[model samples]
Target: MGKCKGLLERLKNNESIVVAEGYIFEFERQGRLKAGSFVPEIVVDHPELVRKQHEEYVNAGSDVVLAFTYYGHREKLRVIGRENELETLNRKALQMARDVADRTSTLMAGNICNTTVYMRDDPEAIKKTENIFKEQIQWAVEEGADFIVAETYSDLGEAMLALQCIKKYGKGLPSVVALVPHSKDHTLDGVSFPDACKQLEDAGADVVGLNCGRGPATITPLMKEIKKVCKVPLCCLPVPYRCTPEQPTMQTLKDPKTGKQAFPVDLPAHTCGRTEIREWAEEMKALGIQYIGLCCGNASHYLREVAEAYGRSPPASRFSTDMSQHFIFGNRKDNKPYYSETLRKEITTANYK
Candidate 1:
């Protein structure tokens, strides 16, 4: 067993310690300063940017800093004409994470997800997927990853395959299998949450739970259901978007006039704030969740709030001598109705013919 396994065992024995896993794909996507998938390309061109994100998470109190390899698989890289850079991408991502984690004595986790190509009928495709997972896991272990996190998997079969790969190639490193469910009860492939978690546990997952499909509000009940069946330490890293079962993805937003899809980051209407995340962390801690963390759209400020809620010292960026001075934009000195002259004139003007 590896260090993460030992840490998880200590946590499971009621050690009163909480592990925070902070994801960086969304943060990196935003930092890429353009509109496209920021996978292997970012790892090749912006290694420092990736390192900076890892540093921020570590400073924000993340116990584990995951490598920015969420979509660095071969198939995903092929879409951007960089499939040949798979080894470099995965190794560099792990190195970047290890570098940042070393500075703060934080754990580093290697990440793998679904390949987006589930051809159960095609044996050749299955072999390809298996090889991809095997290679990724090997690199993770070789690159000094403290653990392996197989996340955002919508299919039970694929999730199990990832776990199997880790067990076979990860050399006894701790592994977490987090499923992306279609609803509160079942995974996207119609497998019940309990059944999915149970299968992963049986397949040697050190921890199992949900991530990336919904927010804390929706995932709370799902976590309860998982608790009823899964005996291992649970992991819940919900996406920060305000989505529901009816609308799983954030791509549902279409422009009213142009009918073009808008990005979730561009709209704050569905984003989770610090207060909500802190409340969610409190609830999870009460529910005996040992591995608590954030998923997509997770920022340093959000993780700082979670850390503070758990009675841990928040990052320096979130600390201040005066509580009222915590707001980046200073609070108003007085309560008064104020509006721009153009908006006020528009409100008072009569309709034109």
Candidate 2:
């Protein structure tokens, strides 16, 4: 079959692409994967679940179906004693993603994240990391992926290595590289966010920006900084959480009731509502971020709001909220005249009581 329009062609035409990440966290929330391990063994164990998620994101208006191969690398699998299944998992994830993208007419991106074993000045660790990236890139290329997405790297070196591997093995496929910074607003190795983004662009990344970690509140300001220095398209995919300046990253957020960290789970209280996600999408558009998505705490519903904000109505938009149809807050003229004026007034003012 013929390839769909390329990512660069769409972006060059000034289109806003919505990518839906966060599969590991979303599946963990759904009880499909382990929380701490986060290895995408589901691609090998329950392939149907992976396919269903791709369908959900596509229906929710994601223009890209990024393979859920985020941490499906050598290091992570080794941790779980499943290193023998590395190639199987990566290839399975890519094939599953490609099938969904082909059926839904969305872009399929091969995904690779930080090796979690990179050292700043150690050559041996860096070499191993590059090898880890190379093997994954080979499978993505062989699977006919549309592009490669390398993300969630706290170390600039690791992110750069991922990009390098993609460029060498991707066979002309586009690359989207994103970093995940902590509270200090800099990479772990002391490079500032803006500087690291600039370096990535200079190193031939097709698109460069930030992802994961900080939420809209924190990532927006950093995107503004990166935009000023980089001429390439900037991507902004933040976690769907109400992150504040005091608690800049999700990991630092606390349970107000229990007075303990509420990251991995127990984040419902801190989750950003649909309204908040819609507003954040609007702000990202205003800031000129071309690649907009929700990271770790994302859901299809949250992304539907994002798609609506971007002015594109995918199939899922049919179910979008219409307050006029609400039983209490609705104002449709067809409502039965059963309630008296006093009752209507009381209902409207009930929240104050």
- In model 2, the clashing pairs are none
List the candidate 1 regions with Cα displacement exceeding 4 Å. 1-6, 15-40, 244-267, 317-322, 325-353
Clashing residue pairs found in predicted model 1:
none
For model 2, what is the alpha-carbon lDDT of residue 328? 53
Report the Cα lDDT for candidate 1: 0.75
Residues 1-353, model 1: lDDT tens digits: 12333456666676433344434445545666334554547778878877877777777777787887878899888888889899998999999888777777778889888887756668888888888888899999999998899988888888888898998999998898999865546776678988899889888898899887677777778889899998888888886666555555445534445556545445355777778888988888889887887776777777777676666784644562354332322344442235434454676689989
Error of 2 at 266 (Å): 1.5
Per-prediction TM-score: 0.83, 0.96
**Tens-digit per-residue lDDT, 228-343, candidate 2:** 99999999999998889999999999998997999878778899988989998999998888999999989999999989899989999999998887555678767635674557
